[model samples]
Each structure stands twice: as C-alpha cells, then as structure tokens.
Target: MRWSKALIPTHKEDPSDAETTSHKLMLRSGYIRKLTSGVYNYLPLGRRALLKVEAIVREEMDAVGCQEILMPVLSPSELWKETGRWDVYGKELWRVRDRNSREFALGPTHEEVVTDIVRNEVRSYRELPFTLYQIQTKFRDELRPRFGIVRSREFLMKDAYSFHRDEESLDETYKSICDAYTRIFERCSLTFRPVEAATGAIGGSHSHEFMVLSDTGESEIIVCECGYAATDERAEGAVDPHPCDEAPGEMERVDTPGMKTIEQVSEFLGIEPHKLVKTIIYEADGRTVAALVRGDREINEAKLSMALKADLVVPAPPDVIEKLTGAPVGFAGPVGLDGIDVIADHTVEPLVNVVVGGNAQDVHLKNVKPGRDFKVTAFHDIVLVRKGDRCARCGAELNSFRGIEVSQAFKLGTKYSSGMNATFLDEDGVAKPFIMGCYGLGVSRTVAAIIEQHNDKDGIVWPLSVAPFAVEILVVSMKSEECTTLADTLYTDLKTAGVEVLYDDRDDSAGVKFKDADLVGMPLRVTIGARGLKSGVVEARVRKTGEVSEIPVDDAVQGILHILETLR
Candidate 1:
C-alpha cells in the first residue's frame, strides 16, 4: 500500500489516556481508534495486520485438520440456558432483547452453539472426532477493562471447538491442537509459555493457557526451575515441601502476645517460616472448618473451593472464625476437634513435628505431629508455592513471574454435554453424552502482546511476522524532482517485484517522514533522498535495527530482499 493513499497517522506526543505502549503506538500510528472504553475501531493499518494474523491462524488451524465455519455472533439465550452457563456465567455476559422480547446474547464463546451443531449432525461413533473453528467478534461486559486489548469487552477472537466420542480421541486431538498453537504463536513472533491452566467458570478437567511473560501481565504463573509450572486453576499435583526427617520433638506452648501475622510470629520465635504450621479458618458448607497449611504458603482458594464443593468459600471474618475453633481471634488450632474437619496442604504433610496453633489465646504449640498430634480428614496440594521451593517435577528450585494469557485449550470432558443432554446413541442404543474440547486465541490481545514482547523505546518495532507492511519507501521531499523521481522508481520496482511497499509521497519534512516511518512500524524503510540522486545510491533501512546501507539504484530490489531475509 502507498503511504500517501494509506491512513498512517503519526503523533509527536503519546495520548494522555493511553495506558499501554501498544495502545499508544496503535493510536498514534493510526492503526486503531477507540470507540469507547473496552471497545475499538481498527483503522486501515490495524485491519491489515489483523488480516495477516487471521490468515496465519487459518492456515495453522486447517493444517491441524480444523474446518473453518462461521457461527452467529448473536446466540439464543435458550442455548446458553440449556448448558447452565447463562445462570453461572454471571454479568460478564451481555444479553439483549429482540422485537418479541426473547433474550439473545453476543457470544462470549461458542461452546454451547457449537455443541448444538455437533449434537444434531454427529450421531455415530464413526463420525466422532471433528473440529470446527471461526474468527469472529466476541462480547463481554468486563468489570474492569484495562490494558487496552489485553482485557477488552468487545474484541475479535479465533475459537475452535473439538468433539470426540471418548477420552483417547479427545487426548490425541488435544495434543495436535497444542502443537498447532506452538506454530501459531511462533508465526506471530511471540515469546510465550504454555502452562497448566485452571478451569474457572469455564468448568473443564484439563486446560492449558499460552501466557506471554511481561511486567505488564495481569496474571502470575509460579514455575519451578525443574521445568514444572502450572497456572493456579490446575496445579493440584503432589508437591512435597522437602521436609527435614528429624524425630518428633517434644510438644510445648509459647506465648505470642498481639502477634497475628506469620512474619511477626516467626520473628518472635526466631525460627524459619517453614518450621511453623499456619492454621486458617473458613466457613465451609454452613460450618466452620480449620485448614492447616505451612507458614511459607498461601491457600490455593480454587483447590479449596473444589474440595469443599461449597457454593462459595472465601476467607472468614475473625468473629466468625473464633466461634468455630474455640479460641480468641488471633489464636485457633487443630487440638481435639471432632465435628470440625481439618484439611492439610501438600507442604504441611511432610513436617514430622511442626509448630501450629495451640487452640488457645496468646499461645501456640511446638513439635506437633500429623496423625499423631492432630487429625486431618482431607489432604490436598492447596499451598501457594514461592521461590526456593523444590519443583514438583525435576526437583529444581521454583520461580515466579507475571504473564498475560493470549490463548487457551481445554478438555471440557462432558461438562456441558451432560448438562444440555447432548447425547448420541451408543451400540446398545443407550444415550451417551459426548466429550468436548475448547480452544481459543484472543485475536485482538495477540496484537497487543506482540507489541508487549517486541517493541523498543523508539516505538513499536513490529516483528516482520505480523508487521502491517513489509516495506516502507519514504520520499524525503515529495515535491523535489530528484527525490520524487527516484522514490517513484523505487516504489514501482518494489511493488512490481511483489514486495508490499508503503510510499511516503506526502509533502513532509525528512524528520517528519523518518519519524512517521518509525512510528508506523513497517519492517523495512527505503529512503530516496537528495544524496541518492547525487550518488545514484538509494538508502535501505531495517526498522528493528538502526542499520542503513546505501545501495546502487539498479540493486535496490536486491538490497531490500537481502534486508528482509536478514530480518527474518
């Protein structure tokens, strides 16, 4: 595309309201314009970039045997209600009413709609494994829409859903899609990690999220140096807290006056935080249950929520907490509890004789033993892990970092199929619900994540993989005969050679032209200047690296190709 014919707006100052670099660059460069909070209107440049990304996604998804299909952006509320998602999905879902007052929703996702199609078409096991995908707009009423496209309420998404008759088929297809995602992110030039994911709200047994590591990321992923990593939703694996196998020490009580925090108590006793057992009280199933975890840990609320199978399980208030454990607000322990069930996090299990609450005011117990000193009705890996902890996989130390999730795939395992009675006839003529898998990539967020992972101080140094244009040919002085003649010739040469070029034919200054070229973030910039006319040498520059070379006019095409190959 020619720059004179394109809408590549360049700004000297960053927009005051722009919170993210991607948002600022995109707005200033005229890639996109905001319609409202959490809503955007893609301009010419952004539309081209989105089309390029969509093309790559289509190719990769099709390579993995996924068939492209278009589902309605507006879905019937009855379909969602059948899956129980309409009630459970909360207010994030946007609902509307038609002329008849029947409810409809702008799809947040297409699981129910896709499953409805599968339930009608796929009858026998022979036609079991099928994948259908689409690139479409999705709507959600985000509670706090921030970070631009990273958390937009209305955005474009590429969602693929796979249906299978059994677990083995589902597992095989799941692996195939994961591999496709690997290729997809690589093509987008995004540095990402596929970590184990939690199935919150979207109930599923197995899930994985592709997270791009960045300081601006909203979610945190705790990873062990042993290559063991999991997002909070699915990290219920067994983790031994690497306890010291010393003999059970004597039990004693120590007075802890006015110290409620773990740090305060640890400093008072002059012991490692790992040596203390932290007992937490919560209201579960209309009764108070005390959960004991290590001091160096935080409770995995998701795991606890799943274990209790309660309607809601959050941290209880001290007044409500004191009533259950028979102690003052700051003091509560597992001493001789019969009705109150105790849950132990994975880390606290290996402690031979640990210090815990004494079930009395202003006192705590030391050398307490599990099974011998206290009873635990349930055991789980609900402890929040931190650095220096051993890996659950290869015994390496753990580390933590924040990341933004750009894509996800999950084995839904009949969660909705069973609820909606989406069943097929079995060999014995009995109805069996189909197992399902869901895959999604944030089309808009991927664009922002690319900027997050790729940009530099100058502006967005768009990676060639997703750049709006491959080359930008700037005419330093569009009105000058020498510059215009050479610029016109170079533009024709590049375009005729099947290279995508954006020619800056505008009557602008050299500084403004160069600045706009950088701001537009095209990978290559070929400048036709006064020096080029004097020496018969045109300048070709690579945007990512501040490297420019003077090439003979006849060899301009070859120089541009070489630079493109080098950037690749």
Candidate 2:
C-alpha cells in the first residue's frame, strides 16, 4: 500500500465526545469514523486490523475441533419465545416487525436459534458433543453506549455453542473452549484475567469472563492473592461480625424532616453510616420482599436473585413502596412490617441499636436492634465485595481493579436445550435434553482493548501479530532522486520478501510523514533520507521500543526482515 493512494486520514485534534483513550486514538489515527451515536464505519486500516483479530479467533476455534457455521442476523421471535427469553431480555433485544405483521429480533446472542437447529437435525446420541461457531455481527439496544466500540450497540463477535449428551461431555468441551480463549487473547498481546462471573440473562450454571486490566474499564473485579478472582457481582463477601456490646435502647420514632439518604440521615442523627441499616424494597418474581444491609454497603441484585431463586428481580416501584409501607419511597423499613419476607445480609445480623426507617413520612427509628424490633426470615451473602474485604478462599484482603470484558465462557448446562426441548435418543432408546455451553469473544472490543493496554502518548502501539501492516517505509526526502529510488527499490524488495509494508511515496514533508507513521503505529519503520544515504546506511526504528539503528544500504531488506523476526 502506498501512502499517496491509501485513505489514511489523520487528525491533529481528538474528538471532543471521546471519553476513552481507544476512542480518541482510533478517531484521530483515521482508523474509524462515527456514523451514529453507537455505530461506526471502519476504514481500510481498521478493517485490516479487525480481520487479523478474526483470523486468530478462527484458528484457535478450529484447532479445538469447533466447526464454523453462519447464522442469520434476524432470528424469529418464536425461537426466543420457546426459551422464554422474549420477556427476560427486556428492552435490550432489538425487536422488529415484518410487513406481514410477523415479529423478529436482531440477535444479541444465538442460544435460542442454535438450539432450534440442533433439535431438528441431531436425533441420536452418536451425533452429540459437537461445537459450532460463527464470526458475525451482534446487536443490542444499549441505553447508553460509551467508550467507543467497547460498549457499542452493534459490533462483531465470535460466538460458539456446544452440544453434549451428559455433564461429563459438557465439562470437557468447556475446559477446551476456555483454553482456546486464553490462547486467542495471548496471541493478540492482551494482558487479561479470567474471573468467575454471573450468568445474567443467559441462565447458566456458571461463567468466566476474560477481563483486560484497564483503569478506563466499566466493570469492577476483585482479586485475591490466593488465586481466587471474580467479578464484584460474583465475589463472595466474608461476613465480619462486629459484635456491639451496648445495651439496646427502646426504639423510638423521630421526625427527621426531608432527610432520606444515608448521608443526610447520618448527618442529621449524628451517627456513622455503619450504625444504620438500610431497607431496600424489591419485587422478586411478582412477590414483594425487603432486603436489609448496612448503610455503608450496597446490595448485589444478582446475589439477591440467586438467594430468592427468582427469574426476575428489580427494585419496587415508588407506588408499590408507598402502598406497602404507608409512606413515600426511602422510608420503608422491616420494623412493624408484616406479611412480606425480610432477608438480611450476614453483616446485619450482629448489629445493636442501629437506626432504620420509621415506616412514615420524614421519620426515622433510633436505638432499634435486630431480632427485637424486626424479624429476618433469612440471612445470605448479598453485598457487593469491595477493597479490604476478606476473601472467602484464603482470608486474604481482596484488591479491586477495573477492567474491560473481552471474552466470556458459560457452562449453560440444559438452560436452552431443556427450554426448547432439544433432545437426542440415547443407547437405551430414551430421549434426554442435550447439555450445552456457550463461549463468546468480542472481536471488535478486543481491538479497542488492545489499544487500551498497548498505547503510548503518541498513539496506538500495535503488536506485530495483529498490526495492520508489518513495516512502514518512509521516504524522508521525496524530492531527492537518490532517496526516492532507494525507497522504491526497498519497498519492492520487502514486498517480494512477503512483508506487509506500507510505502510512504507521497510528496509530503518529512515531519508529516513521520508523525503519521507514529500515529498509525506500524511495528517497524525504515527511513530512507538523503542525509542517511550519504552515510551509506538507512535508519531503522522500532515502534514499540523507540530504538533506532542504522542498516547498511547494501543489506536493507535482510536487516528489515531480521528486525521483524525480533519483533515477533
């Protein structure tokens, strides 16, 4: 590719709306252009980089004996309804209607469609334990898409689904897929951690997320020195009982006008946040329940759903709260409350004389003690794990960090197959649902994450394995015939040697060419200038290390190839 003909439009200023480093660099480097709020058009350079990532994913998946197959972008609503995900996915599933009034969904994931296909085709146990994968586009109606392609509404993904006859078969395939994921990310030069994660709407027994460590990431993860790592939603919080010995005072209600938040109530009552218990009202599976946690802690809704064994768990509406507690929102408490299940966090079990809502308008209860003032139906680990929290494994202090989720693998079990009635005949002539597993790698997001981890002050420092071009040849003085002739010759020689080289044959200034080269982040650069030509050598600069060396003019091609080998 020649710079004069290539559409490598770079800018001097970053986009004002860009909030992350990857977003800013991708725009300024002319890799992509925004078409809409959550949509982008990948230019030539960006397309090449994405293709490289896709190739790696294909090789890894194929190496694991997973066959490649393509599914439709639009999946029928019947398939989603068979699995009861039509309502479970909520507004995130993109719904559309055909001219004949038939409904279809733009697939966010293909669990339902794949299950439908397998159920119709595979009828015997002999055809079980196979995996099918596809590299295609996925759509989701993101409420707030941010951080460029990291959270885009539409993007490219590589998703694979496996079918099995029993738990043992599913387990074997799950481990192999996880191993392939590790190799895929390693080859892309990403520094990541595979942490246990919640299954979410996927309805799986367990899952693991590959998170690239970055300060600008949206998800928080907890890691312990004992090799126990998980997303905050899945990490277990160790219950440390701070047993208070103070004698319980009689509960009394006081008029705290307009102080509802913990900060406001604590400041008004002259108490610490830990001395107060917060009552959160949630509607779980059409039943109202109250959850109690320390004011300083947050309720993990995922944990709450698991504890309740409910398909859906969301906060109660303001009207429901008002009708149940005889007060406005934020004033509902467990004290004097009846006919509703009251679940308490383990940390709230050893409290004495803790303040709580008064179950009335602008009122709060003081000197209230658990087991005396209210009844807790059960206790569970239902709080978000944070820094300084003890790990459940080795009791070490857990550390928290932010990261970008690049890939995830789920042991789906029979969630989809059982729901859709996808079964196969066994040796005994009995039919049973196939055990299933799901694995996904975000191809586009991996590109963005690579930039997040491997970027410098100038621009993206692409790794050699996934770089758009392996080498960039810069003609420092295009006006000088000697420099031009040597650069053209080197460019042809490098091409003949099977190197992906970008020749800057444009008549631009040396400064402009050098700046663009650095911005595009080619792995290696060869500088052919009149000054260097006079010294009987050409300059070779490594993009990652910023180390420059001189190669003798007689051996430019061989020297460049050797440096490329060192880069790998």
Candidate 3:
C-alpha cells in the first residue's frame, strides 16, 4: 500500500468530544469516523485490524471442532415470543414492522433463532452433541452510549452455541471452550483475567467473563493475593460480624426533624456510618420486604433476587412504605415492624446497640439492640463488595481494577432449549430438553481494548499478531532521487518476501511522513534518508520499544524479516 493512494487521514489535534484514549487516537490516526451517536464508520486501517481479530477467533473456534456458519441479522418475532423474551427484553431490543405488518427484530443475540433451528432438524439423541458458530454484526439500542466502540450500539461479534444430551457432555464442552478463549486472548497479547460473572437476562446456570485490565475500562473487578478474582456482582468476601465491641444501652426515642437519611442522622449524632443500620423496603413479587444492611454498604440487587427466589425485585412504592411502616419512604426500619418479612445482612446481627428509624416521621431510635428491640426473619450475604474488603478465601485485603469485557462462556443448561421446545429422544426412548452452552467474543471491542492497554502518549502500539501492517518504509526526502530509489527497491523486495508493507512514496515533507508513520503504529519502520544512504545503511526503528538500529542497505529486507519473527 502506498501513502498517496491510501485513506490514512492523519490529524495533529484530537476531536473535541473524544473522552477516552482509544476514541481520540482512533479518530486522529484516521482509523474510524463517527457516523452517529453510537455508530461509527471503519476506515481501511480500522477494517484491517478488525479482520485480523476475527481471523484469530475463527482459528480458535475451528480448532475446538466448532463448525462455522452465518445467521441472518433480521429475525422474526415469533422466535423470541416462544422463549418469553419478546416482552422481557425491554427497550434494548429494536422492534420493527414490515409491509405486511409482521413484527421483526434486529438481533442482539441469536439464542432464540439457533434453538428454533435445532428443534426442526434434530429428532433423536444421535445428533444431540454439536456446536455451530457465526461472526456477524449485532444491534442493541444503548440508552447512553459512550466511550467509542467500547459501548457501541452496533458491533461485530463471534457467538457459538453447543447442544448436548447430558450434563457430563455439556460440562466437557464448556471446559474446552473456556480453554480456547484463554488462548485466543493470550495470542492477542492482552493482560486479562477470567472472572465469575452473573448471567444477566440470559438465564444461565454459570458463566465466566474474560476482562482486559485498563484504567479507562468501565467494569470493576476484584482480585485477591491468593489468586481469587471475580466481578463485583459475583465477588464473595468475608464481613466481620463483630466490627465493634461496645456495651449495650437502653433504647431511647429522639426527635430528628427533617433528618431522614443516614448521612444526616450520622452528622447530627456524631457517629460513624457503620454504627448505624440502613433498612430499605422492596417489592418482591408484590410482597413487601424490608432489607437491612450496614449504613456504609449498598445493596446488591442480583444477590437480593437470588435470596428471595423471585423473577424481579424493585423498590417499593411510596404508598406501600407508608402502609407498612406508618411513615414516609426514607424512614422505614426493621424495629417493631408488622405484617411483612425482614431480610437482614449477616453483619447486622453482631452490633450490640445501633441506631434505626422509629417507624414514625421526624423521630429515630438510638441505642437499639437487635434481639431485644427488633427481630429479623433471616440473614444472608447481600452486601455489595468494594475495595479493601476481606477476601472470603484467604482473608487478605482485596484489590480492585477497572477492565473491559472481551469474551464470555456460559453453562446454559436447558434455559433456552426447554423454553423453545428443542427436545430430542434419549436412548431410553424418553423425550428431554437438550443441555447447552454458549460462548462469545466481542470482535470489534477487542480491537478497542487492545488500544486501551497497548498505547503511549504518541499513539497506538499495536501487537505483532494483530497489527494492520508488518512494516512501513518511510522516504525521508521524496525529492532526492537517492532516497526515493532506495525506498522503492526495499519496498519491492519486502513485498516479494511476503511481508505486509506500507510504502510512503508521496511527495510529502520528512516531518509529515514521520508523524503519520508513528500514528499508524506499524511494528517495524525503515527510514531511507540521503545521509544514511551515503553510509550504505538505513535506519530501522521498533514502534513498541523505540529502539533504532542501523542496517546495511543490502540487508534491509532480511533485517526486517528477522525483527518481525522475533516480535511474534
């Protein structure tokens, strides 16, 4: 590729709206352009990088005996309706109507479509164990899309689904795909961790997310020194039941005018937040319940849903609170409550005397004992884990870092197969739903995450396996015949040797050529200047390490080939 005929529109200044490093460098380096709020146009350079990522994913998926196929992006609503997701998918699923008034949707995932395919073809257990995959674009209408391709509404993904007849067979395939995902991310030179995750809205039994560590990432991950790591939603940590050893005192009622929040009461009483108990009212399947946690901690909705064994749990309405506690919304408590269930955190039972709401407006109870003053139905672990929390495994202080999700593997069991009637006859001549697994890799987001981890102040530093081009030949003085002839000869020789080379043959200044080369961030750069030609050598620089080595003019191609091999 020659610079004169390429669409590498390098710019010096960053865009005004760019917030993250990948977003700014991608635009300044001419890799992508914004088409809309959460949509983008991938230029030639960006497309090349995305293709490389897809190729790696294909190789790994194929190696695991998973066959590749293409599925339609537009799917009929009947498929989703059968699984009860047509109404449960909420606002993110884009619904449209055709000329005949038939409803359809742009798929964010292909579980319903794939399940319907297997239901029509497979009848007996003979064809029970198989996997099919696809690499295609997906659409999801994000409410507030930001951070460039990291959270785009439409992007490319590699999704695979497997069918099995028994739990043992499903477990075997699940482990194999998890190993394959580890290799795929390792080959791309990413610093990532595979953490346990909650299968949100997918209704799976178990799942693990592959996350790349970066400060610009949106997801928070917890890591312990004993090799225990997980996302915040699924992280389990130990809470000290006896956080303090204070003597019990008699309960007293105090008038607190306009002080309903924990912060206000803590300030007015000159007490620490952990010394107070925070009670929240929630409606779980129309049953009003009060959840108790320490004042410093927040509620984990995922854990709460699991504890209550309900489909969904939301905040109780204002009227429901008043009816249950005889007070307004923020003044509900577990003490002296009636006609409702109480779920308390494990840490709340150890406190001798704590502050709580008085079940009446403009009043609070101080020095209230748990067993003496109030009672709870049950205790569970429902506190959201944060940094500095003790590890449940080793009791060491847990650390946290921000990361981007690159891949995920799930043990889906029979969630989709049972719902969609994808059943087959077993050897015993009994009909049963197929056991299943799902694996996915974000093809476009991997490119953005690579830039997030491997970049400097200058620009992107692409890894050798996923770089757009292997080498770039820069001509220092395009007007000088010596520099032009030498650069052209090296370009031809490198191309003949089967190297991905980009030649700067345009009549541009030396500064502009150098700046553009750095912006594009090819692994190897060969500079042919008039001064270096006099010494029978050219300057070769490594983009990642900034190491410059002088190579003889005759050994330019051989030197570049050796460097490329070492990088891999």
Alpha-carbon runs more than 4 Å astray in model 2: none
- Candidate that would win on TM-score: 2
Candidate 1 segments whose C-alpha is farther than 4 A from its true place: 18-20, 98-101, 224-226, 236-290, 309-340, 349-375, 427-429
TM match of model 1 to true structure: 0.85
Candidate 1, poorest ten consecutive residues by summed lDDT: 232-241
Query: Per-residue CA lDDT of candidate 2, range 267-378, in tens?
Result: 9999998889999999998899999999889999999999999989999999999999999997888998899999999899889999999999999999998899999999
Give the per-residue lDDT digits (tens) of candidate 1, residues 1-568.
7776777777889888888788888888888888999998898888988888888889999999999999999999999999777877879999999999999989999999988888888787777788999999999999989877779999999999998889999999999999999998999998889999877777788889998888889877878755667775555344545557898888878898876777887898887888888888887646677788888777877778777776446677877766666677667777676687788886777787677777777788878888888889898767765556566676676677888899999999998889877888767787799989999998888988888887776677888878888998888787788778777887888889888888888887889888888888889888887867689888888888889888888888998888888887
Give stretches of model 3 more than 4 Å off. 242-247, 253-261, 285-287, 316-329, 358-363
Q: For model 3, what is the C-alpha lDDT against the true structure?
A: 0.88
Candidate 3: C-alpha RMSD after superposition:
2.2
| Model 3 agreement with the true structure over 1-568: per-residue lDDT tens digits | 8888999888999999899999998999999988999898999899999999999999999999999988899999999999888888878998889999999999999999888888888999998689999999999998988888888999999999999999899888888998888988998999999998877777788989999998988899988999999888888997655466778999988888888899998898887778889999998867888899988788876788788886567889899889888988767778899778888888888887788888899888889878789988888898888889899999999999999998888889999999998899999999999899999889999999999888888888989899998888999888989888888888889999999888988898889888888888888889999888899999999999999989999888898888888889
lDDT of each: 0.83, 0.93, 0.88
